[model samples]
Target chain A: MKDITEKPMQQWISKDNKAEKALKRVKQNTTARIGIGRSGARYKTDAFLRFWADQSAASDAVFTEVTPETIVNLGLFEIKTKCRSKFEMITRPDWGRIIEKDQQQILKEKCVKDPDVQIYFGDGLSSPSISANAEDMLQVLKLGLEHEGLSVGTPFFVRYCRVNTARTIGPLLNAKVVCVLIGERPGMQTDESMSAYIAYKPHPQMLESEYTVVSNISRHGIAPVEAAAHIVELILKISKAKKSGISL
Target chain B: MNNSEQAFISAGIDIGTTTTQVIFSKIRIKDTSGFGFIPKISITDKKIIYRSRIHLTPLTHENEIDALAVKELILNEYAKAGIAPSDIESGAVIITGESAEKRNAKAVTAAISEIAGNFVVAAAGGKLESVLAGKGSGAMTLSKKTGKRVANLDIGGGTTNICLFNNGKVEEAICVDIGGRLIRIDSDKISYSSAKIKECIKNLGLNIKEGQNIYNNNIVSDLETIASSMTSYLTYCIDPEMSLPKEWKDSPNTRLSNRPDIITISGGVADCIEKITSDSFAYGDIGILLGRKIKESTLTNTSFYQKSDETVNATVIGAGNFSFEISGSTIDYRNSTFPLKNVQIIDIEIDNTASTIKRKIEQFCSEYQNSTFALAAEGIKCPTFKQIEETAKLISSVFNFPEYQNKPVIIIIKEDMAKAFGQALRRKLDNNRQVICIDGIDCGIGDYIDIAKPVASGQAVPVVVKTLIF
Candidate 1:
């Protein structure tokens, strides 16, 4: 089914078009669809099918769940937000942001406290992103921070998660910084995209402006390993600036 | 919180066969990225604030460039423009035309660049000059904007540099020894004539030499013929359909493989093309005569011909505004300083096997001893994390041979994978080696790269890739 959308964008332009060379050159810089020829005032069959495939992929990404093996392999025990299922997490966004009191206690007891940086993975909208990118990104990120002579706290996974979970985790664990590597809402160009929402000394009262974001982390975008390296640098900056987002 | 803007002063100095010129420009870089996105820093504008008066190039009796006089000229221009050397940041110092062949050309350029700016890189060689002139003459911008093939002929005093740009990218560039000042007439005598132009004169059944009187010996028609010959040589270099004479087939020209849709002419000789002079020897050279011939030639009548706004200042303007390029937004660097210069690029193909890659690196290591060179390649496309790790492992084998163990290992990838690759490679090398891996920079073998300080809030670095090819 991906045959339609899987072809390189540079080669997707119609062969007979005289502007194929120019179109191919422009395609190298962007991911948006362009120069897809029309047929009788409608998208060509291939273009239409590619669009449909991308749409379906986005929906599939939202509904699916990360496999148990992925969680166990990452060497992290699982915790859940207040929401129990995907439907509740989508309908009640507030509930999706909170960790239960018992789980918070467990997080405090099990996780390292007073660390310079705390990293966590969240399958927000796309479960596939965590299973795909978390291990590699976390490896690079931990090594990068450790190389900078900063202490990195334990990593964990939170199911049915949202971005605001970092606000709670940072204060509960007495961490200086909290960075959530979470799955992003899928777009037509890619479904595997993820984002890193980083904040300094986060708490329930922190404003939205306090969170510094580095988004579009995936193989199709900024490769996870690369994004992780950048995130490591950002964490170091936050420690010096003593702030993130607009202030930093 | 909001978009950030950074502006810096840049200086460009061009020492040519007939003239020496300098220009100061204000280059502004802007962060165009919106919230929730990575910083996308780009050079937003380049404004030429001051242009120096073109001066005659000082030459020693030995035909070498008078380095002190040239340095003094540049320093005077800087003072006149009210710019301190410390105010300038990034630019290029280029030696063009036949002056680049002088015995002291390299030393002169180095001295000028050192006094010009902290980050100014001294650059020469015909290929970089051709591209710079094309950029400065506005032909390259037009091609990029219109998506048309544009070719520029920068006809200076002792050499004509030809570069063809296809939709804003350099296709090919060549420099030919066809210019106006190759034969200079002083009042009633031919003061100087190069050996090559003398051979050209002999081909026309004329005996011309240095220190010969030519005031009444039909010099006008002979000079016209010579100017027309030079014009023909330029056309032969750029136009695919224009065949050279039998003897000129093996001449000093690197012709464009594909014909351009538009053509532009610039440089000192180009300054004379727009106007005709009653006195042909006004500049004590055939520059005006050559311009008159080009104006009246069939080459100008072609529908593809376009007049360039910048004539004498094209290469200098290009040096000021176009030498630096931003690297990919996502890159990796550690324990490195700004402005690493003259690092040779060793382009290698990463084959499927690691041993084959090791052998290639071994060859490069032996070939480039006592020098710093980066390993560059068009890396894997949309590589998985595993693939990136494997490729990094393959490249880390360079450390096995002691040539790359302690020194800063620089890797340039054409693909957008340097961040991931650098991270993985750093891990393989025990997280302590100074690894600088960058991407979205396109450079090849026989080219040298210079890296400037981090810009766009440290998202990327500025790089100057100087290519030298015949």
Candidate 2:
């Protein structure tokens, strides 16, 4: 028993050297959390709404905070947003797919019976950076859409939703097109960000080729409003071409 | 090597969920006839001179008949060892898997009982049968060798059995419902289903139905799915909530560890040796294969035993060995046993006297549809006739109530379904009162009587109940 204890003790004391090496590696490749709440609840809802409102208002487009029920009547368009952490984003994909059952029932009652288009904005894993860059991007998007005379759908804010949820719910409500704005996974050096993913004929099992995406839409990266304008121009091109991804 | 030289052969049989195995040994009989008829004489010169030929019966769908085949195989092996059935000294049987729990398990035991009638039936008699059923020879051998408590976890293709031994004696054993074949795999990531699993087993050309609800003959994929699921369960089993033994927790190599002493894997999955090393080199199959060889020889000596070709014969061998051990009386193998007797059943009935009075109130609400008095009520702000009628149609469609499609109808119920319908209506109508289910008891007065005043007065919230009324 004494021999057994001594051998393990020697191994433990030597493990400090290994720990020091691990610490050095961690410092060289830093990963940070940007917009997540300390508590597990949806504490970042107000911040998300405020950011969405400012961005939409700056672009001359009215933004309304609607439940899953209200969104069905708003027709379809694209959504945009971001998140701050990788673990928070990956573990909760199902939470962002659809509204709760009770909310879904309410939407069936008050919203339009079924609309042609439905788009959503999700914060994915980098909400903080996406929110910061949204204002400038929306202005650019509005101008591009107007220049092409494309009739965009009503826009609104969706909290804690994912990009895929737009594809899933869009077809259920008979939406012809659905787009989502979500934040990309953040690396060590960069934090401020957002991205837009668009799809046509969206449904539960739509192919990846049915959509398009634009990443790094942020102040320190791609200018937010400018990226939004580029996205709108691409949307017009897709609508004229009647296709997306490899097909276009 | 002289004419007077005789041999005492001892054998062990293990009948597993997916396979059967047997093992045998022949020892020189000193100062006694090799036949088991005479009493044993203490002799230090006696020693095992030669081992009998190890044999196995192929598994088959006609497993009922396969037991006879196993007995014949055992007989042949005994002959090869230069001994007759009556001449063999001792043996043991360990039954396991679905066969042990079959409705005709007793009948099968009775049929095999005659073959080893001379020897004590260790597995068939008294309370020891169930206890010794799944205790493969591994645990038995370990117990005898270590003189300490040891447990054997027999992992088969479709099920896993855990048998424990203490102080060179059998204790308790249990079979967990999960197996290697049940684990699920979606590409590289392995996971388990929290939902019920339905699987089907096809033996030879005949499909044998097993599991919750048998659908198609796709046992291989189902087994893989189950095995993957066990990986997750193995993880959960180590949790403190599960109350696993402290030894299991303190060990650094739990489940996926490479420590050979901590755990051992045995069965069909163990054949994938590379996979075991990477995951946790904790599996072995030698004990079962050795058991199978002994059973085959026991059956060959008995004239009544027959053979089959569909399955890896292990159970029959186990059964044969078990019969020999009890009859030979070389060891007291009857400690663990369970008795079956005195079972009972019962039934119940209910009366329906209160339902007759509730029908009269429903009739009164129907008459108020076209009346001026009904329209004059406060909060009777019915939508334009078309909107009210359309709302009614939508409600009917949503609730699958096709009969009320073209009528200006109001539904009234006296049960819980009515309340659920009301809640559904409230949700669908956005708190509108186009549909409602009123609650009250009839006091045999006015046709439409309000037994209790409304709890809270508000606009009628449309509620849709989608339940079948009895």
Candidate 3:
């Protein structure tokens, strides 16, 4: 077979020049408006510290950074963050969901053997919304569950995570339920909001019926605290009903 | 029409990573004794009454499995045929490549079963790839004339499976978990940043800004780059082990026979065959060739089978054919036991809101005049373990329903949260009722609930439910 250069190849090679010009225009326009916040420039540095402070002050649940060395228990909570971009969310669901395989191993090493529930926060397509709303929601959820005399789990943060990853980790930690608070794909009206998706016996092959969802559960739509109250109620109902999402 | 007048209708459902296919067929029966009896009279022609196709995005998020996509596809296909959903007879669902790998494969299957209001069988685990390879080869043979045994390779969106056949019998098969869409392209090495990729797309004049605007917008240009990178990786990975005759080395791109005999490419990535072959030495026809062979083998085999005469809708056609096969049969042995004197199969449909479980029980009792000896309700979703207990309570109360007073109810609830819900139900039942939990993939409750004799069944036992604590 002769190695003929097809039309798709031509398009690929020519994309570089086109991308450069377009990128320059976008940078100029965005810089003029959003001004690239300090957190944007130093995402892993100062942002981490601020996130830690907020997380620590918001809840008494043991908090840990999702690093390679961090250990995860069955009922532990984890979250992922990413920039407010849909392309990244659509193209990179795996990145937003599961922890890096090696990092998952580290979690196994440092965390408890098994837990009752595992909660994760992911930036589905809106990092800012997840970071802002997730903390308050978590705090309220903890208070409600604890008040109901249900044991609370450890909580952590994930960078660029998706909803399924929480389910994947839930089974690994022996958790009966896994909740993920993530930024929903932003619409024109709002870019700073998040949602919570809770699943029972989450694994790679869970069905929508096995999950319970509380969408628009953020400060901008449903207040984080209020959302937390609903989540607590839903969780209780789910435990009693033994179902979630569409099945309910 | 006489009482003996009958019609054969079948449906094939293919759940791929990027899209789902549904096909329908109607065959006339001159006389009807029964399905297996092969009517005493014969008809000369079988016509395709309806055909429909749709492209869909894979369920990547946990919350995305609302069954709306499947529902829309099924309903639209029925509408296209100008028939109601209940009018459809039998159907088969083939979960190939990515859909089979989803975390909620069982739940998705159960949901579809409830909506379809019929028995739905999912080809999963090792069976998916094997059946796919077998069926794919059968599809290819419809288009080509080949005497030699060949291999069929299906390059889908997330994975690739290769099957070798000799004289229409599957000899060996292998599935590789790498696909075209999933090929990671590191832009940093290509002189472009993530920001640049988005900019280039915007420059294409799509007006797509940040966030949710990304979906439904064409990113064909960006996809081209990703395709190029993917081709490079695939070529590097499969080249070494690819068993190709040396004769085809000079014109390897066109020598489909020596390379794979017949490659039938299905799934979302197959749509980008042109891109995959460009800037690389591989050929796109390799996939098609494989598809042809698979199709041919299945048709030629000596077994109960139905083959498609058209191109590009094999999965749907297959599903439709299977649906007809089931409808024509006497009883659904897969979903219910035989000798229907003592047993009954009760299917329940629940909504996606609160109090659905309670409502399902109400609906069940209002519909059935007598207490069912065995109850199996499909499609229940509860978020927490607490909900599972409530659902079990509702199932237990079914015995108290006026029609079911004092009747022992062996209740089977099919929900996505089978493991969690099962645990919660077991705790609530705790010696009060006989509660058994069967994993959807492991055992079909309809097949086991009314077993005449008690034998050890390989079912997942109910374990105590636990939560994740940090």
Full-model lDDT for every candidate:
0.84, 0.37, 0.45
Runs of candidate 1 with Cα error greater than 4 angstroms are: A8-11, A14-18, A25-34, A37-46, A101-114, B1-3, B247-250, B349-369, B381-383, B387-406, B419-435, B456-459, B468-470
List model 1 lDDT by residue over A87-148, tens digit each: 89899999999999999988988899999999999999999888778988888888778877
Better of 1 and 3 by DockQ: 1
Comparing 2 with 3 on TM-score, the higher-scoring candidate is 3
- Angstrom error of the Cα, residue B50, model 3: value is 2.8
Top TM-score prediction, candidate number: 1
Which TM-score value belongs to model 3?
0.32
Worst 10 residues of 1 chain A by lDDT: A1-10
Docking quality category of candidate 2 according to DockQ thresholds = incorrect
Model 2's chain B TM-score?
A: 0.38
Q: What's candidate 2's DockQ score?
A: 0.01
Where does candidate 3 stray beyond 4 Å? A1-248, B1-6, B27-48, B58-64, B129-147, B183-271, B274-312, B322-470
Model 1: pairs clashing at backbone N, Cα or C within 3 Å: none
lDDT accuracy of residue B168 in candidate 1: 88
Clashes of each: 0, 104, 109
Best by DockQ: 1
For model 2, residues B1-470, the per-residue Cα lDDT tens digits are 01143444545454444445555544333323232111122222323333333333234452442666656655555556565545434454444554455454455445443453223132422123223332333445455444444443444434444444554454554454434334333322223221123321221122323332222455434443333334334333322243333222332222211111112223443333223243221222122222222233321223322221112222233233322211110111011111111101000011111122122222433654432110001111211222223333344443333422322223333211222223333334322233333321111121121111111111111111111111
Question: What would the per-residue lDDT of candidate 1 be over residues B357-435, giving only the tens digit for each residue?
Answer: 5666667668876677788888876676677767788878766457557667899988877876787787778566778
